[model samples]
Target: DQQVKQNSPSLSVQEGRISILNCDYTNSMFDYFLWYKKYPAEGPTFLISISSIKDKNEDGRFTVFLNKSAKHLSLHIVPSQPGDSAVYFCAANLQGGSEKLVFGKGTKLTVNP
Candidate 1:
């Protein structure tokens, strides 16, 4: 069974508006959640992350929220710009050791000018 899932395959937002991407997980053992942004021809770059101990984490215009009880998480981008358009993937893993990351298919976000 797929442990991670991105229910929305895509999202669209007007420039300077907010963009929200949702994700859910079935694994309760996952403690570290991460969001990665991928450009068309490049590898995914780490965006933001949250530990199970924290409910939220933010960096600049990007924010990540985790609800451990619901096994759900979300990424929020405020004042999204056209350049921010890209595919975002959600990943989860155990806190330590050689655990591998389980990634969601990805959600493509389009920021319109």
Candidate 2:
């Protein structure tokens, strides 16, 4: 069974607009949540992360929010750009361990000019 899921496989947005990506988790034990962006043929790069203890974390144009009660999280990107177009992966680790991480299939985001 998958612990994390991204219901939307793809999202298209216009440049300079806000893009929202969502994730849902079934494991309540997850203590860390992360968002990664990957370009074609490139390894996923860490974008932002939020600890279970906090409801939200922000870095520049990217922000991640965690709702423990809802077992859900979301990533928001403001003023989306073409360079931001990539496959985003939602990941989680149990009990803050670096040993293993559960990842969602990913959502492909396209920013049109």
Report every candidate's CA lDDT. Answer: 0.94, 0.96
Instruction: Give the TM-score of each candidate.
Output: 0.96, 0.97
lDDT per residue (tens digit) for residues 52-95 in model 1: 99999999999998988899999999989999999999999986
**Count of residue pairs whose backbone atoms collide, per candidate:** 0, 0
**46 in model 2: Cα distance from truth in Å?**
0.4
Top candidate (lDDT): 2
Alpha carbon deviation, residue 24, candidate 2 (Å): 0.1
lDDT of 2 at 80: 97
Candidate 1: worst-modelled 10 consecutive residues by lDDT: 93-102
Worst 10-residue lDDT window for candidate 2 reads 93-102
Query: How much is the lDDT of residue 95 in candidate 2?
Result: 80
